[model samples]
Target: MTIIRTIPENEAVGEVAEIYADDVESLGYVPTHTKAMAMNPAAYGAFQALIRSVAKPLGLRRYELVTLAAARGTRSQHCRLAHGAKSLKLFDEEQLERIARDYTGAGLTDAEVEMMRFAEQVGRDAATMTEADSQRLRDAGFTDQEIVDIAIAASARVYYGSALQALAVDVDTPPTLGEPLRAALVDGL
Candidate 1:
């Protein structure tokens, strides 16, 4: 049972309306993930803010890279499917499949794999992190600030993914995008 009602795209108002409009224009639909957050405008807005705050500092690829790993680590198909769709824009089918099955086996560059490993750890147990963790990222060429940003991005995904899952928000529908990855999104769903 859904613990919170999702706001229909057309019925959304104010911030939700604006956000929904952007989603529809860019992705073709209001993602179920977004709709779930729309149940509480404040929470939805906060999610948006958190994302924007990291946009420049983390950049899209790195941020999504960490996020996808964390999503998989958390066993959240909702997040995995969504972030997996976004990742398809940058990576090939085989690479994405590897990431889906196991990032370490994906043949990603050492730096990329290291980032995913860090994100997975953050998702699994942040308490386990130590100087060695920072050293690993440093060895991989990530600066202290970048490491913090990666951690923040990975940690933030838990909020929406868990909430949507707990609220039983749907993820069966694929996001709207065109070209090479459109089918990939469907496959992810």
Candidate 2:
């Protein structure tokens, strides 16, 4: 269990209850991360809005890929497992396994690889990034807007992932994730 004391689901009301309801409807259970964030429902709502805004223009596949890269860079096992399972909607098992193992050799397009690398770098070290980094994304065929979106997606992940880590939230392994891919993300091999 997390060190934080969250609103218990049974006693939840108002925004917290609503948040729990939405998760229960979509995910079939309330995620531990959701419960942790719901300690401050308004802040949690704002965070969700930020994620939706970033995801809306980028599309699900791109967001998940960028998120996975960011999670990997930060070594956030929770985000990695969660997003890795979400990525299964877009990629086959073999391809996802390959991406988890090594995305460079996973047969992704050059543009895709560049964006993931950029997202990883953002999570790993944003301060060290220079204009040349943005230029690399541009060279990879991304527009300024797309590059900005990728950065936001990656940076936002650091915020969320850091919160989970700080609270020592338990990693929720989605059942949809296969063993090999799970092992790769969780075990880092």
Assess each prediction's global lDDT (C-alpha) against the native.
Answer: 0.75, 0.88
Per-candidate TM-scores read: 0.86, 0.95
Clashing pairs in 2: none
Q: Indicate the residue-level lDDT of 142 in model 1.
A: 92
lDDT for model 2 comes to 0.88
For lDDT, the strongest prediction is 2
Per-residue lDDT of 125 in model 1: 78
lDDT of 1 by residue, 62-143 (tens): 8888888777656677787777767767877667776666677777889989998888878777888899987899999998
